[model samples]
Target: MAILVLSVLVLLLSLYFRLKKRQKNDGLNKFPEGPSHPLLGHLPLMTSTTDVIDVSMQLIRNHGKTVKIRIGPKILPMRTSLLTADSHLTEFILSGNKILKKTENYQFLKHWLRKGLLISDGDYWKRHRKILTPAFHLEVLKEFVQVFESVGDVLIEKLRRCEGTPSCDLHPFVTLCTLDVICETAMGTKMNVQSGKNSHYVQSVKKTCRIIIERSMSTLKLTDTTFWLCRDFYTLKNELKVLHDFTHNVINSKKNNKSIDKNTKRLAFLDLLLKFSQDENILSTDEIREEVDTFMFAGHDTTASGICFTLYCLADHPEVQKQALQEQKDLFGDEKNPVITYPDLQNMKYLEQVIKESCRLYPPVPIIGRYTTEDTEFDGCLIPKYTNIMLFIYGLHRDPDYFPEPEKFKPERFDNFDGSLSYTYIPFSAGSRSCIGQKFAMLEMKSIISKIVRHFEIKPTSPRHEVKLSAETVLKSLNGIKVTLKKRP
Candidate 1:
């Protein structure tokens, strides 16, 4: 009798779920239409990694500017929102508005990220942003130029060692270059991961991203009990535990050591954060760790991806390469080149255009996700609450309307526009959530490109070395991006 009762109850609950799910889909027809599947809803559309950006673009193309997508079970009520390339809607979402909140998918990041700026929302995000903004200021970045120059020179020498090689994987080199910068700039310590054996830190960072991307692809259907019981999840937990121990020990060592003067000439980001930790008006020690970790994650890979794309663009487009080379010659000709001054970088408008163009073609973070907290209307379509919203910058950048001949590599498009369409060409994103390190990132990219183009001419070993992109948090090549680096006289 007891078994019979439980079976009937389970059947009743399943029936209720099917009915509720049907109602949600029926409601979506009243708004913009999107591809849907029974039981799965629009979940199947984004299952593949390669076409996620393309899929988003297709949605926009099929359903106009604003579209509604149903994701997961209807009982969850998480509606996926896409705002197309509508500038007003873009501004609205990124403006840090109260009504539009980060979705619950971000909750998954809390496992690794905690309350860092990237994961925080509302008051916590604002408070941290205020305290952290000072570190990336113009004056502070100016101090890092010497370090940038030194690193650039070292990297050039490293590439010189590979001079005769017909082809090389440039991605690893770019990753090393940026890793060196972040270690110096963020940690005040130098860990040259570029040419040397991979450090524990570098490997750990890559591993974490790979796992996170893999986990993101699957549906989080396991119950807490099931997860606790699972062996695979246990292994993941232990790996993360190791990473946590490593980061914590590094922070603790720096804190306890009194050998280095607080007034040391090198104002590394770690030093700055340490200073903040001491001040009464600033962040607590726990907060300091979160912010430092945030910078550590943010500083390296995104910039590396940007630089890699820039080099690929230059190598692929000879005319653009020629133009960039001329610009470097005109700006800093002859004389085994002085370090790129802030002024020199600022003046290299054409190089800036080239980087922007590369970013358009290959954005580092191809998709930025947000979750809606409340029911919202976007372009006359009802976006139900808890939806995962994806702003597909990759698709938007490639849209023919915004960028004609979008597939062609052309830096000149930026030359015609007077930098007004910042939101339109948001390689670093725009509005309140704009990358805090934009100024620093630009300086590093410009300085590196200036040094590189001036010294060597890059080319592909085979024009047939098909360029491809994959995502492990940041978009990168499936295999490393290999190309020929020819020495220039």
Candidate 2:
């Protein structure tokens, strides 16, 4: 009986695949020309995130508009429709039209993430966005200046401790600093991960990113089964349990106790979330935990990668470094006695432009993936239901058409700029599902950049400090971004 049931299920699945493949026949003519494969769709080379980004670029070069990729049977052909990054198609997708919804494969994230703003769609998305939007108001963000500055001070002190060392990996320090800031401001907890070199929370967060990267790269056909049996998922789950336990205990302690201290005020995200969670049907405990975890992970890592890259770019170009130093001096005086207040940070226009240019060159989230549901027509192509679309943010940013001299780093490009075409610049992504923590991220980046430039004279360590990238889900440097930071007089 068991054998019969297994065989029957496999046969049904095979039939479904055949039918789906047949429907894909007529769609290719309307879409951009992709490789012709016998059985597998154009997914043969697109197994990794890096490959996915590469293929998308290739399609843009070859097909010019929309590219249709067919996933083979083994791969389950997830996200077969790679959308064209043109003005019209991009605008169509980004506008909150009722016809299109967030692809269904985002459900994989839902298992761990729950219905947070990043993954939720439709009315659920709308309501949650409304409630969460107010939480990130401008005044509230401006208040976070102290928390950001405090973290910056600690980071400067840490770098001072390592002054005599030949060089240090700036990535880890930036990551730890941002982590400290997010934990204190977002959740009102004192993680102090930056203090201890080997904090469990820090390790757990790193491990979680690794797990997600692994899962994303897994063969799509086996993803459902593999996730069910995977040890990584279990490990991530356990880590989240630890985080939840920590969060709940903090919340419980703060619930009835009204003695507000300086420390309590410093706990930003947690306090806001806790206060909001008390409202009727506002958010579930599970939901609140997911948001906190999401912010903890997403909030810290993206900003860290951006800052790391900015430092690297400065090291690579000494002239730009000199200009930045001059700006720093002009803004806050000499390095020996530098102080960056909130208003000063706001006025550092040149520094802001540099950060933008760095992020443009090396976006933290280089590629974003979405799955299409139901047959759809985009850019004159018929996209079948359940097709996976890979949006190549890195490729789009580097396209010479949109950004002239795409390879060169020029902060001045944005100095006199009006906004470009929506599809042209997607460092933060677009649409209803764009990054919610963008403001927070900007504040964090500005503070870190101001502090680092003000205190240190950055120089390349080795003659060849190669900017190689490791493809964990996030583009991180495997060797670490090593640079020498000389203290300024």
Candidate 3:
């Protein structure tokens, strides 16, 4: 009787897999196939590998640009995604208004960022985008240049401590500096993160980011119930409380404070939101917190990643660094620490090229996700509704057709380049849903990078460290971004 029961179970399991395989084949027949398991789909491929980015690149090379990857277990109602590095498909997806909803993976951020611009969709996203658009305008960004210069000064002083060291990991120092910049410019609150005054806030932010990434990757922690049972969930809960409390405190302080003269003080992004809240009454206090928190999250980490990678590239390539330094020297001749005004930042054209090239090689946000809201056709291939789409920005930037000799770091390639095209290089992404703070981010990066190049002669370590790139919430190096610095005389 026991043998008979076991035989029946085996037969049922076999039948289940067979049915699932057939359905998968029928559903994704139009798209190119990627390496996948019979029962687990592509989950095993991603989970088993430590080099996720490299593995993904290889998969794209083996398969076509647009390949269908099945996710989760076959026994359950799993997700099907079209992972595309194809520029045309990327343009089709990103340039369209019909598919603005983010994929389910972004749900992990909702607990922390709430329904801010990064995760919000439809009318809410549109409304918030409109309200926040003016905050990144030329006049507003010009006002923030002084903030960047002050933050850059702090960064230079911090790095000066490590000047004589054989090598130093710049990631931590750069991260803290960007954190300070975002807090001051976005919230009108000085976090003093660089000085270690708000260690709890900094740690909480880092912990929350790690938890979100881990939760997104873990199949076991994907569901709310399962996540609630995990140890990480508890840690994340505590960290989120710390983060939310900080944002709320800032909001409360801003609301009650009335001593500031509006004309003399530069308005922050938070100030703008408050003005909107008071005048139009379109945003609640919680909504204001959400936007502020969103800016804090989006603004800092991504820019830090960009700055670190650019510095690494500069250290690795001496000639490129020399050219960039020469441009800076030409601009601020004989001035050791010239004030980095908006025009000075704008005039550092070669430095801009170097930054752009580094971004091409290592985009901060390597992959961005969107889901189809309706059945869509791309290049004669029909995509069913509710399908997730992973736009491989890393792969798009490396497409040799658009960027010749893609592996080589050639800043000159961008001398006369037009990156405005939706399908081409999009480190900050493109189209209607593109990063609103692109201008602000670029200005900040230019200000910071130019300052570093002007004040220090950056060089690679004696052994030369190779960054092991990891595709996290943002692009990060598993090994630190190591470089040696000699203060310019």
Candidate 4:
């Protein structure tokens, strides 16, 4: 089987190279300005630093909105990518159903998540999504509000300990709290990350994410053989086992048991999948595990980054934080330990705008990619079937065309904002392939952020320019998001 797989891979490479050679010979036009090396092309440009998010953003400014980039080693011509900074072109690519298959790099995730919705394409993706869409529906997501607010209170209590501190790093607290929420919501298992007992589980998940990212950014490890030869490869496999076992154990615990409680009226994400396993489109154990992993990772990192950055924005703009607190105060007047209902979340309109602006300034996923399934034409250039289109979410959000003075945090941009940025401002991406968990993410972020801002006054030490960003599936601050906290008196 290995021999056959290798043989087929060699044949595919030959065919790909032949097609690319023909296109090169046609000699359409010039490539975008980038540090193209003699043999490595643009590989060295990004591989030199872990800060690819900032690097890619700067490249768009220097090389123009539509920039040509290259990744991977010298051998694979398929490593070349087009960085689309224009919102129209970005919309065009993400909006199309026929061309939305994620690039090959996403396959690297199968070790951790398997062929779940985040990576799978074609019929399988569509079918699985159909089964899972109801899990995130408005009514169903309402069921998880108690879960969100429960974790939110835990996070607030954790932050309360750091009150009156000179400066505190909020990301770690936010990450652990969100991790616990996802585990309970998806796996039906309480990970207790907020209490610090299950720090190992959190580390395993983070380590797995880091390994996947390091593999993507490494020029040598871009190829299967090169990655397999490295010591880190073994580390990734070992970490994968910890995470896989953690998730598998959850499934085993709930396989035969149908326990209902006072809080949960219906089955949660993983519970629903298991509940549906006896139907016509029965999900296998492997399928259930894949979906659980997909939701578990999605539910944890994206919202954590978002809430952290929203706090960063609040810390940066004191006036905005004041307004948010005022809004919260209006909702729950002098009632300490107030219940944050779903209706309260909806009424916090100004806070919602603040979250939108925060997402614009520091999006969770910096860059999203898709490979053309067939020859596609855009901006009067023919994009070959296998070419990589790196949609710069960071760049698109900050583009001057859609957003004037995009650098500044202006929550007013979304004030009475009639969803004009349907294509332009894609914090959760756009079109059919957009994140299904966006509502769930928003609920979690707003819940915790509202709680945090209400309890503590965040004071940012580092300005926006000082905090460095990197693309790690989720956007992260290299210098770390530093802020001082004072309990609201």
Candidate 5:
């Protein structure tokens, strides 16, 4: 029976490749090709190695800014994607309305996130985007500054335990803090994840993120039917249940208690959704949960990763850290715990540059994907319709043409920076479909990092820890982001 199953798989693969060969003859091979196996294409090349980013970088180095990467056997609609680091091409894709549909790469999130803004396209995306736009407006995000301060206080207290230690991993501590921040800001419920209260929910989120990335990288687990055969399928099922249940309970609780806090006038993302649902009839309960869950997923991990990378950059570059700390001193005048306000966060121009430079080196979301709905002509090449376009943001940020000495951590490069670079420096992305929470993220990051610098002197480990980059859903280090923290005198 096993032998019969193996034979059937072999026959199917052979037939699939045969059809792929015929389809490729139909003038679809317009882009420059990379090294790939005829049958498996780039799937084996990408999955065979642990460092997917390195493989992608190597491909770009060998094939210039744009390289054709085939990952599967589908050919009529085409499973072959164009991997590009070109800013001009990126602008063409990101700035256009026709290529707004996200590629199948993001489909793994559907089971967890549903049709939230991150995955939804066309009219549904438009409606939800319109409805949710106000939640992250400057005014609404200003309300979140208090949340950032309170949550950042917890992070500082937690990191105090690691103070004076030889070395500590900052990723886990920062991740929990961001999770807590997102829980409070997105759901208006204090999760206290940093205080070690909601272990199950936190673990479920971590597990779900890991499982989704694992499934996305595996060719066999791309489809639901085949995914069921993998062990992670069951794990993902249980984790999603926990995540969905937690979000649903929060939504229900918020619905039951509709009284707004009179003192602070703080409205969470969930609160705004509920208001829209009641006042404007814009969102249903399930839709509310969908957007809430999307915020929870998108909000926490990306910011946490960004913060960790920035901290790592600061640790490695002491002069930059010293200058950043001096800027903090200038802002707060040696007040250990100064009340950080919106204007203060805006005044953190140098710290903002540090964050941008860190993001340039290690963008939380290293790559974004878009699908071409129709045959598109750009740079004299005709890309076939329904082709997946992988925008390699990491490679784009490091391109020498756009950024001279791109590998160095030089924050001052952003000094007096106009918008001359266009799409080349898009750490938060660009265009209409750009990150909605970008301003919130920037403010939160500025608030948290500023408080951290004011309270602690961060330094690199004695051996100099280096992060082994992994191209997960969010960029993570295989080795933890390690640094030593000393309480400022």
Candidate 6:
């Protein structure tokens, strides 16, 4: 009995010392320490989720642009990570295809997205990316512009209804419009989301995204088992069913369409997927659903955020809005039923700058996370392998060093913008893993904004000072982008 007690005591001592030695050797001791709890590490102290942006802002202000955060329990050291606003460091991490595996928080989304392109890594991601690349071809994208213009017209009509109302939240309206555009172009289905259709699917996607953010930040639901047991998980599971069923039905209904065999000029994203679905193990039904769902999820939400924020910025700055409208007039000339062609979109260079500046101010996908597959060194700091890496694109964009007068809404900044700086000005992100639909997203924004500017004069109900930001599904306005509209002559 005495020998047993002695052996247990030695084992406990060794474990304690081993963990201590490992932590010290990892050089985490040099990291800027966040508020720590005894057993909870930094989790208890962290204001995660949408408010995590505020928390990050504080951390950046207190401890330079680059700070380290240690979340979860001390016993599990994998939760410790480096949060950087350093462009050089961000470039080092994102530029590498080898370290492309997403951080652990993304795992929560796998419950819905499965091994979709956004969530998947390694050879699987490579294969899917290769297959999906043709779907974004210039010819394919130009075909998508027809959907964008039609959707934008519907959105303008929706705004016309609120012409007499005091002011309204623009996000929900804009979100529905983008949902319609993405579904039509990506899935080859006219959802009429702008006409108040697809509410259930829309609600489900939004709810699933909310649950994802909640699950990622909840310490109680750290592991998958714990998350699966929660009420949110069940709700999301049901919602995922609705989303999956909707996509699955659409995909199968069109799977064997005769058009899939032809080398047509009008190849929507799903057409490309359907073309390869019949080949040997190329893509199973579920695999097709994964990509469709991913495109649907990723394609709409981010673009909605971008579009809404750009409108908000324009409304807040009438001069900017006027400049954008003038640029549009120069090309379209108060034309009746002005269908913005691909070239028309390209000419709205000022509007493009406005979108870039707005995105820089309020980046839709504020932060990017990656897991270090190998030990990485940056700025003389060694980030241990398997540690969560956070690139604070939000903070980086707001940094005065890279962008002068970072708080100011200045679209003119992009007038002389240089594209060569891979690290800085990454609203759509940079690197091999940069957003796939960036060009599509840009054209879509230009399409909607130009239409709104020509058809109506948009004004902010509340000033920019009053509008607080919430980093929800995307960077959203807490008070919403409340705007008043007047029909233009």
Candidate 6 lDDT by residue in tens digits, 263-329: 7767668877877665445888889889989999899989988988888788789898888888877
lDDT of 5 by residue, 42-141 (tens): 7777762246789889999888899888755535333678899999999998888888999987899999989999999999999899999988888888
Number of backbone-clashing residue pairs for each candidate, in the order shown: 2, 12, 0, 0, 0, 0
lDDT of each: 0.75, 0.73, 0.88, 0.81, 0.88, 0.82
**Tens digits of per-residue lDDT for model 2, 1-489:** 999999999999998788677754746446665664656666567566456555676777787855666666423443355656564656666654533455544555555567766677668878878777766777778888888888888888888865756677898888899989888777776677778943877777777666666675676323667676777777878876666676666667766667755344334766676677775558877677777766776788888899999998988888888888888778767654455566877887888888889888888887666656567786576766666666667777787888899999999988876885766777788877778788778888988887888788888886657766654556677678988888877
What value of lDDT does candidate 5 attain over all alpha carbons? 0.88
Better of 1 and 2 by lDDT: 1
How would the candidate models be sorted by TM-score, starting from the highest? Answer: 6, 3, 5, 4, 1, 2
Error of 3 at 405 (Å): 0.4
- True lDDT of residue 75, candidate 2: 33
**lDDT (10s digit) by residue, model 3, range 1-489:** 999999999999998898677566554577776667877788777862246688678878888787878866645437778788898888887888988999988999999999999999999999999999987879889989999988888999999988989998999999999999999999998888898899999999999998888887887788897898899989999999999999999889878889755554479999988887888999999999999999999999999999999999999999999998889879888686887777888888898899999999999999999988888777776788888989999988898878889999999988878655547888988788999999999999999998899899999998998998888889999888999999998
Candidate 2: minimum summed lDDT over ten consecutive residues — where?
Answer: 73-82
Between candidates 5 and 6, the TM-score winner:
6
lDDT of 4: 0.81
Native-referenced Cα lDDT, model 3:
0.88
Those runs of model 4 whose alpha carbons end farther than 4 Å from true positions after fitting are: 1-21, 25-31, 48-50, 71-78, 258-264, 462-465
Which pairs clash in model 6? none
Name the lDDT value of residue 45 in candidate 5. Answer: 74
